[model samples]
Target: MEAYVTIVAVAPFFLRLLKLLTIVLTSALLALPVYAASSPEQTLGLIRHTFRSHRPPPPFVRYTLTRRQLTNEGFPDFIWTYTYHIWCRTSDNAALGRRVFRGGSYGSLEFLRPTFNAATDPGPPTADLFEPAPATKQATPAPIFDRLREIGGVEALGETDYQVLSAVTEGELIHVRLLPRREPERNRLRELFADRRTYELKKAVATDRLFTQFQSYPELYTLTLGAAGGYPVVTAIHGVVDDSTFDEAARYIDYTFTEISFPATMPDWYFEPSGYGAHAKEAPQ
Candidate 1:
């Protein structure tokens, strides 16, 4: 009878120990992705996979974009809102748009580009306005990915392109620091923060060495990403350009993506420059 009593007393303690262990194992499994990345390559692969898997549909996509310019003191100076209608083929991209300017000398401007065919064009493809203009030529609309590739000179993330400095966890995000391996790239140093669970890029800051006629200045670019149509999309971009040669205060520009979408169908003539003038009245405001 005494041995039976001792057995009953120990049974509850054994059950409690098993329960505690189960809870710990479950928590560790849930956090596997956050801690799984031991090196920069693995972290980069996760980001690359997210981008490739969430790529927008091909042929054409239309969306609205809002851009704002801010002063050095963080006051808004200019705001422009516009609709982007773009069509793309394997080798070419074309766009037609109308922009309404506000918060400054308010006005509206309509513009169209016929083609940015890679086969015959001298410059990179122009299909989106948010793209930064190349130094030699004027600003034009181009696909974001294409512009990034042209500027970064890298089609995909590779160990040779960046040297990872460090990775750390801050709350629910993993922040990583990296430096460019090559010169003349806009991304001289970059700090990227991503979601711990999803591994999606949340924010990034890039420091670039931009040169003018007299000297070089460190231009800082800040980017913020958010979810759009189940994929991470750039929601805001701000840049501070240092003025080393001139005594002028630093130049600050802010670009915001207020609206974005992937339209199902766009008319045939919408993509043609010759036909754009005729269809200006029909374009979405």
Candidate 2:
């Protein structure tokens, strides 16, 4: 009888020990980097692939962005949602947005057309249309740049600006952590994440001055891409936004691309804006 009781007690202790060991082992595996062979070529290649733009990426996309403005008390106070149509190019990007609501608190916001592309617009402006190419080197548009930053398009950052701190495979996706080579780059772009096989950018997080150029603030960006028309188009974005022109408190924003399409044709006001391709009505058609 005494041996039976002792056996039961010892069995429970062993089971508890086994459970503790399992947790530790699982955590250790997560902490360690998965290696295939002598070199990490696969991981390195994936990083480089996502940094650069590839062919077949759609030039136009339309998405609904939801901004949940949070208070210092950790409560979502103001929620702003808008549907935006953006045309992206190497040198130009344009977007037009209208207010949408989840509950009923839609505020007054006029979205200017997006015209800055982080992948290339960070450099000097393109040549003038009416004048000679060298005669006019136009200044970079500040608002366009802000739109790019707000939307989590930080791929324009050069490779030399950052170093791959660590990379781990989580299921089929590759999660990479990056650090700035210099302290200055941190103020511009702090982090980036991308996919390997399709060469689609996943996330671009940064802390930089934007919009009205007040001061730099933290931004966490999550991005998603989908295949459309046999090409890649940004499907979604989850981010935190706060800058000089924005609310005092940081806001959690989500950009969901409901429709991704290219303009079949242009209209009479084709020469109105430099980056805009089609009007709001003609975009989805």
Candidate 3:
């Protein structure tokens, strides 16, 4: 009878000990990796890997683009819609065909005619009737990935020109902030947010400042991407060029892409200006 009483008294204590041991083991199992929280280089390496491993879409891609500019008071000042055909091998050579322009000085029915350019040509011809031959040199719009790769100093993200400031996990995304290491970079800051599971860039923001004539002008650019047909595609781009120093309000532009597609086959002449047939015309002046 005395031995039985001792056994009953110690049973509760043994059960409590077992519960405490289980709790400790469970906490250890759920702990995050030490390097993930403390090492910024590792995070950068992962991001670079993800970018390098990304498979670009097929050679041919076509989409519709809608661009709108908003005034300082948030009113639409200009609107443009166009069908874009691009050869993915070289995105710099794209055709903005069947364009429609509205707002600003353009009347409701003032639509710019369709235009196309040859792959070997520098750019489209002048839309103005009185303009000279061989259009003047102008900046051309580029794909988001191309722009990012250029700004980040080629395919490597942590090159000498770029400095990774910090990286941290926030909910379902990994946020990385970077800065330009050289004075000539003109970039003030760059931030990238990627999906935690896939490490694909979901959004990116960059700021740049340019000095001209003893004055400084700041510009901000943002890009957002969405997954389409198992590939990450740029969905929207917004930019603002601050002109407050000249007593002019900031100019805001928003460009959105829709109906993105990657066709299996594209004719050789599709990229040539002559292939546009009767629709081929000069670019807007």
Candidate 4:
């Protein structure tokens, strides 16, 4: 063991490579006029088609995740931050290949860099990295949050579990809201408000009767979608989390996400723990 050390968060360097893509997407989305379809069914069909037309979500990605913590009184601060060298698709056995965690605010952040000397050090690969514990759990979500799950095409909406409440096209955005048909799902709400031009999911609001809920309040997730690459990555995820998930110190909290590239593939080492040293040194630049 090389007496493991903490890793440092990567700057949003990849974004630069992509050419300030977020700004471009924002500008494009705002200018593009959303043509409201005649009917909800037709609108849903168009959304599915539009998304499918794109290259598609890449198989591998890397980015920084910043989490902002807020008080019930509305005071906010940066509480937790993470830099994932490589985050695999949800279908992968491991959620993240290598990452660094810091706990604190901007000036006083407890950042740890991967300071291993790759050449001289060959053993005890960086510790405390990776997510999902490299274990696979195939637990199916209970038959609870059911109503509608758009798979393949629009007709699947008839009797899935979740039902579509409304699919409206407003000027430059498409807002599709969903609700559960059963008891537990009553307090729950699901919606997808996406940009018209790229059909990228920009706003998602829901009550995770399933997500942690020590206490509940009115909230919606305002996400920032970058319309580049085959399948644009959700560069930002802004939303609130309840007390239970927030460590019970606050009434409610707001959070967000910003990631980088979603390339079709990367080298095999990127997905392996030992391969971290090779890329770890590359993020800081």
Whole-model Cα lDDT of every candidate shown, in order:
0.53, 0.42, 0.51, 0.42
Residue 73 of model 3, lDDT score: 55
Q: In order, what is each prediction's RMSD in angstroms?
A: 7.5, 12.5, 10.4, 20.4
After superposition, which runs of candidate 2 have C-alpha atoms over 4 Å from their true positions?
A: 1-42, 50-53, 56-66, 71-80, 85-91, 96-159, 183-216, 241-251, 268-285
Off by over 4 Å in 4: 1-38, 71-161, 182-189, 195-200, 209-220, 242-259, 263-265, 274-285
Q: What lDDT is reached at residue 239 by model 3?
A: 62
The TM-score values for the models, in the order shown, are: 0.65, 0.49, 0.57, 0.50
What TM-score number comes out for model 3?
Answer: 0.57
Ranking by TM-score: 1, 3, 4, 2
The candidate with the higher TM-score, 2 or 3, is 3
Residue pairs of candidate 2 with colliding backbone atoms: 93-114, 93-115, 94-114, 95-114
Residues 97-123 of candidate 4: C-alpha lDDT, one tens digit per residue? 344454522221122221111111000
- Candidate closest to the true structure, highest lDDT: 1
* lDDT tens digits by residue: candidate 2, 1-285: 999999998999999999999999998876544433222334544444433334423434444443344555556656333433333232333334445554644333233343212211111111111011111233433123121111255433234445666666555455666665665423244444545344344554444222323444445545555555654445555666554444545455554665555554434233235434445444321
lDDT digits (tens) for residues 6-32 of candidate 1: 999999999999999999999988876
CA lDDT for candidate 2: 0.42
Residue 3 miss distance in model 4 (angstroms)? 99
lDDT by residue for model 3 (130-199), tens: 1112232222333333322444455544445457888888987889887767642333337888776566
